[model samples]
Target: MTNDHAETPPSGLRIPAEPVPLSEVARFDHETDVLVVGFGCAGAAAAREAAAAGADVLVLERFSGPGGSTAQSGGEVYLGGGTRVQKACGFDDTPEDMYAYLHAALGPHVDEEKLRLYCEGGVEHFEWFRACGVPFQESLYGEPGWMAPTKDGLMWLGENAWPYDTLARPVPRGHRPPVEGFAGGLLMERLAAAATAAGARAHTDTRASALVVDASGRVAGVVARRFGEEVHYRARKGVVLTTGGFVDDEEMVSHHAPLLSGHGKVSDGGDDGSGIRMACALGAATRRMASVEAALIVMPEAACRGMLVNALGQRFINEDVYPGLFSHAALHQPAPWWVILDEEGFAAYSARNPTAMPPDHVAETLAELEEELGIPAGALETTVTTYNRHAALGEDALFHKNPKWLRELKAPFAAIDPRVLARLAENRREATGISGFTLGGLHTTVDGEVLHVTGRPIPGLYAAGRASAGIHGDGYVSGTSIGDGTFFGRRAGRAAAG
Candidate 1:
């Protein structure tokens, strides 16, 4: 994905404040109205909006190209309200409906009153992304996936839209692949292009090490270090920190977000809460540091990508479910053993993708199983016979595989079988990614004012994205994190421009 490059904060938590003249500095990187750290979705949104609002902007990125979490993400933004696509899909979606669902999902701390801006701003952001040249695949008529150019088209919200139901936030809320098939990343890419064309300056490999607070306690520009030396790039107006979560820093994450160690964390090794640390130095109030979702753990036995088997050696979820979700769910298994189901599971996998599995492999799965997969002939026959005899009769009675969805051992068999499938215990584990919903950030007003723990606003200190917490409350809705990145990034940019 080609995006206008944005500079990144220095790697790790090393924001050293060293003194060097502008000339002695390796590069003549000057200041601007805003300095945006991190180039992910949130940082991109904040920098672009600030520059477009007439601010001289300098965006920093640690990576070569733009697209932070967005680049690593599935690219689904969740706004619970009436969307143009939803109108076209003939499904009822409204801000109020989304609001109700969000409120229920997040409980009282969601800060909906302050969060109203997200709802009001979502339509504009969606349209804005579209105007920047994003593409949307229309669903077939009545198929929700087969809808029309009409505002009343049906939307097939993928797994990313799991929290959304048929109530207020109706169908067609998601943007189709912006490019040929790149999801939300396309929108971010477009914005990066727009930002670059607008003359927004950025540097990659240059890191923002420290928040330069003057002796008067007024927040000054940051001291950027590139190569081996320290180069100071000063921001006159303000500094906005958009660095993402610490998903890869095993020690840091284990300390802050223990539950997430196993999940497929989008935050690369670079997204260590550096922004959070810098903002906290300014006395920012962080919140909710233990929020976690299980990574769809993958079962090990299933060798190839096409044929996936669960504990019962059967396909648990729709094989078509985004592999992000699949991988996340699979690795969370209680035990190491996995089960590969018979012809029925293979058919489901095939339906999800015909090319996903080989035809010869799909047919005559039993004999092919022992051949392709080393299963003892005697045990294989015995296991299949037993499953066929009891599985359909509501008597897996052996494992008591939820009687609700048991099936007899049909024709094509699984390549591998689980020796033992243990149910996952819900108790807390030795490790977790329970870091709360992007808190420990500079608490800000809806206007995007960075505040101290004392509730006083810091001059020239602004924040957007996860770096600015509490706007999302203690719990976040499914699609809201990216949505917040877009919504509030713009909010901070607009405010900083003023």
Candidate 2:
């Protein structure tokens, strides 16, 4: 392969990263039965599946090693259809229950086929990860937070709290690998090793710049830049693109998901929208482009035991929903948010989370605290009075907050601004900020076949992971990304190998 034609754009290109024609290629540098682009959780799983299916799989990664955004995650895989771990933890979860919660929580645009398949196959998927050397313990971390604080294997990562709990039986479906803290790195380590062991060859620091299409408009291979030179790699069977999302691309984020522009990105800088653009050039359809996972983690979930109020000092959300759902609700509320806590509540939060942000304004009375927070004279007082009245009866009449978290607000109040805490954490390079990632990409079928704008599957081209939108529609659950990516990657790999 030569670099001379690499800089030239295909004629009448729809996007800057359009696919190249097979006729334009003078020679082929490499060939494989399946070409897996970007060695993230999805790519690793895809490579392993395709190679195990007796296909010559080759994985290309832009980074120095495996592990994309998956390595930066908390390593929680949402699985709950009566798996052994769930049984060991004394939780009876059925596929119907899992589907009910996910269908209700994932969105107004949920893909029923994909959701049904995922729910029904949850147990087998769990076993598959175990077969890949990913460890899971039977212990459960019963907490109301984002990631598990302990090495326990299970936690609730979604709206498995009050309101949703009423709809479906709540279960701890978020299964973490048995690692002390932030085990995403360990998860990817095992997955990458599994892929390589399955005979999938990987070339790191190789960037796939464009897709190659045959005369009939079928994807044939990829044109990549490696070692300061252009290389053409032909995929005799198919190509799978798993290059994550577009969160790291500021221009793409601002245009597609403007709401996520200012928030911190939870990526490793490889989610630049290049893979999406390349696929779109071949008439691939996209969905939920405005969808982004905005995490508003007000640490020491004990704060939910108090009250989350807006600038008007009015309670808006239940305060006990999943942190991501709470954050979405918070984003729609008035600016300058605060979690108002009484002395007892503040003391409890401090005792539990020593690193929790200190109260921004403390006063001996609710009236004094209201004044300090610049709320209207009687707004804060009236809100707290009403909340306390309902709370005294162990009931949240207005918001339907669970009785377990409802409590009366006494005197000596403290207000903590979560926005300030997020800013401070961002400055300190911590993951505590209001970080997020784009949740939308190329539209694909449950088999990972990319769909055309006319609802037809694009032959010889497939996508999984963030490069192609799967389970997530509007909101996000913490473990859904890794779970969806790995599960669908296998399906795509198998389909491509055939």
Candidate 3:
């Protein structure tokens, strides 16, 4: 797969950042046609696909068990483009519509080739998951929330939200597998079983330490530590890295993603930048390293009834936007945002969020509350006046909040501190703390070939999942990570076997 015009690294080929080297006279302890490192959604999908394609595949996992970060997720897979669930839910969607929505959502970092390929193959990928025994019910989740609390298969995770609503007709495409309790863990469980059933072997407690390059400067295998022994696993076809992102690595986060420093972390353990660092040592270029996804959800559905205001008490974002999107905007604003709510709104919020701190200030009038919060003299009053006027008319002229949540604000106003709301809220489903994960890593082609710093594919090396960056830009919609991981993982597996 070498391009004649591709730039080759200078002599003294730097090995991966691990302590060991490819020239350490390593002996092959295990051998396979395709070797996969890190058995999350990406690794599992790669292993299963490679094995299905008649390749001998071996998977190495760091943890002593299954389920990386994917298991802890909400198990929402972003699939549309006329997916079975979307069509079953009576929604008409086309690849063009999906592509348009993503193009607008991802902004400047959107990869055209990747988006095209993903949209075109979206339905096939969804079917692939079904073929692997991942069960997706045919029901549609009626609410416009993040994830389905039941076995419902389809949900509008990103419909009627900013940018997307204007680009194409909104459609519901978030597909969740029918796994009771935590859907993510069930997803990993089924995928892991499918990988093994497809004749792929998995070695847990094995941590890949370095990449093995041959005399031709081509990736030949992996060096991993297993049972206190340095073992070299030779891969005749290729090695695919799916070791997730660097959210757990504080040093790397500070260096590459400092903006995410203060936000809460919702990561599965062992997401510590090792995968990205390893690829970097071999001269893999990184993209969007500063891009991060921070969910700043403060309350449950009750939050939709209120308005989000900055320290200046000026309404900023449409509170009805997907909580994840709202959270992303929340991170950039000046601190000390207050969710302005009236008595009925407060009652609805408090019914579920009883622990939310007592209002920073409560007054019989919005003007008095504005002064108590130290916002400019008439800023809060004017904002409320305009908001309530439009709300009473069932319209949100400024932010276009969904009419369902719009209501006129009355006396006895209370400004709730978001930090306190985040703390007191019950859980991620009810109230999500400001949390984020890294979305940037080794740059790769849509097919998952790891690219050199000079825009050429590194021979015999591939990456997927959080180990590779291409799907989303700085902004994120729910379910994209898991979908990207599995779809690209299959692509990497097929490409490696070729």
lDDT (C-alpha, whole model) for all candidates? 0.55, 0.84, 0.79
lDDT of 3: 0.79
- lDDT tens string, model 1, 317-404? 4333233333434544432223455666556545644333333334365655654544444445555666567755765544333343
Candidate 2 — which residues are off by over 4 angstroms? 1-15, 158-160, 428-433
Candidate 3 lDDT by residue in tens digits, 1-498: 111111122333422465344577457888999999988999999899999999999998877666888988899888888987888779999989888887776655776787788888889989999988889999887665556657898877667766568888898878888854368988888999999999999888787878888666678888877666777899999999999998877777899989788666767746777678877878888888887777764653545877888778888778776677777787778766778888888887677555545556689987788788888888888899999899989989998887888898888888776665456543434333477888888899887899989998988899999888858887777788888889999989888877
For each candidate, how many residue pairs have backbone atoms clashing (under 3 Å)? 64, 0, 1
Q: Tell me the spans in candidate 3 whose CA falls farther than 4 Å from its real position.
A: 1-21, 179-181, 348-363, 367-378, 421-433
By summed lDDT, the worst window of 10 consecutive residues in model 1 runs over: 140-149
Scored against the true structure, residue 326 in model 1 reaches a CA lDDT of: 38
Give per-model TM-scores.
Answer: 0.69, 0.93, 0.90
Predicted structure with the largest TM-score when compared to the true one: 2
lDDT of 2 by residue, 81-194 (tens): 998999999999999999888887777677778888999999999999999999999999887777776889888765466667877898889999988668899899999999
Model 3: weakest 10-residue lDDT segment is 1-10
Q: Which residue pairs collide in model 2, if any?
A: none
Model 1 lDDT at residue 22: 33
lDDT order of candidates, top first? 2, 3, 1
- What are the runs in model 1 whose C-alpha is more than 4 Å off? 1-29, 104-109, 140-172, 178-185, 262-264, 297-342, 355-442, 470-479
Q: What is the TM-score of candidate 2?
A: 0.93
Q: Considering every candidate listed, which one attains the maximal lDDT? A: 2
